[model samples]
Target: MAPERYEADSDPTDLSLKILVAGGFGVGKTTLVGSVSEIRPLRTEEQLSELGESVDDTGGVDRKTTTTVAMDFGRITIRSGLSLYLFGTPGQDRFWFLWDELSQGALGAVVLADTRRLEDSFPAVDFFEHRRIPFVVAVNCFPGARGYGAGDVSRALDLDQGTPVVLCDARDRDSGKEVLIRLVEYAGRMHTARLLDTVGRP
Candidate 1:
């Protein structure tokens, strides 16, 4: 299916969007949302327990104690009358059912990647790709994590040629904001192209 189009004459205020922050377990989805949001982020994180430990893999992120069980909600104003409502998805497999609900009316998505566990983010990339949703991969640079160039990470992920792969520090507001900006710009371009195609149709 073709990607969704944004009306060329739509109001800027009406352009407020729902953007998903999807990634694998301990990939910093929650951190990214909270870092860049202008409003206080709402999180549904719960302390990990023995029951969860049995199913949740904390191999690289063993330092992490909490998990987002449902989702993280936040808001950011990109510019005058243009805003984004971010919905950071729960990374564990059990909470994946919530993704269907969170993704409704979404404009685009950002799939965060952790180099320490590169394979963990594959599900997010695949989901957006299959859905034809505009998305960008933001590699969250953690301390002591192996360094990978954007091209190397892109190749490792088997990403489509045009997909944007950028480095980010999810814990930093500026870094996280840049990731969103990149995604918004990419999605905006795709939307504009779709609208143009529609206009040019005979």
Candidate 2:
């Protein structure tokens, strides 16, 4: 299906699009959603416990005490008519079963990456790629973490040629919003390309 087109001069009625904020554990998925959301974000988080220590890796984010168990929900209005509904997926492997349900009808996704544990983001990138979902990689620049340029990060992640790789501070609202904007634009272009391909086929 051709993706929904969101334009500045869209209809006056509200046009909401679903966007998934996904990444590895403690990679700032929840932070990004909370910072950018206009309303109080709904989070399904649980305190860390001994039982989960075996499965949940806190190697890089050792200071983190909680984890998102289900998903985080939030909303942000880009303009008068265009709005984005953000869904943050759980970072751990066990909760991955819920990803399909949350990703349904999603316009696109933002895959958050932490340079300290860059490999952790591979799963999210692969998931979206295999499903043909348009996404942009937002590298969350954590304090004390090494910084990488967009080109370097793109090459390291082995991302598609046109996939955007932006360095952002997930805790900053403006930065998060910019990441969402990039995703929207990229998804729109991808949809147009697909449509043209279909028409040109026969």
Candidate 3:
């Protein structure tokens, strides 16, 4: 399917779609939102000092100082008429309660994974699964992160056969937009399937 393209002057109300970007700390969810957001992305960052050493995991992301304390909000126009609202979830384990409210009306999600700590994404993956929310897994390509194919990540996540897994550079606008398109397409397919099931069609 051709990707949707959005131009300026589109009505936000007419094409608003909410999608969640979720992952563990330092996994690039905020970067992905900023890369494609047409509006000034809203971020709530709190400095992580050595005092946080008691609670923060400074294993691979030792240099990181700030963490997303709340959700990151951004907007993207993908087609001449379509627009998407990107809601990046707080990655810290303590703020997971916010996800339940965020997921309420969301169409779908993109779970970002850093190969350096692929296991860190398990909670985000499990959150969507537990809620039966449709989502795509985007393995964010990092400079020193381990190299893994999409198929390998899919296997590691044990996702359904129909789930979409794509590689992305969250810092690149085109790459971030492509990941959003994948989530849109995945959610569209699931919506169609649900409608068919409701109509008693295979």
Top TM-score prediction, candidate number = 2
Ranking by lDDT: 2, 1, 3
CA lDDT of each prediction against the hidden true structure: 0.87, 0.90, 0.86
Local distance difference test, candidate 2:
0.90
TM, every model:
0.91, 0.93, 0.91
List where candidate 3 sits over 4 angstroms from the true fold: 1-13
Top lDDT hit: 2
Residue-wise C-alpha lDDT for candidate 3, range 47-119, written one tens digit per residue:
9888887888868874687889888999997786678988899888889889888777778899999888989
lDDT of 2 by residue, 1-202 (tens): 3344344345656688889999999999999999999999999989989998998898989589999999999989987788998999999989999998888878899999998998998999999999899999999999888878889889989999999999999999999999999999999888778888978855
Residue 48 shift from truth in candidate 3, angstroms: 0.7
- 150: Cα error in model 1, Å: 0.5
Question: Which 10 residues in a row give candidate 3 its minimum summed lDDT?
Answer: 1-10
Worst 10 residues of 1 by lDDT: 1-10
Against the correct fold, how does model 1 do in TM-score? 0.91
For candidate 1, what is the total of clashing residue pairs? 0
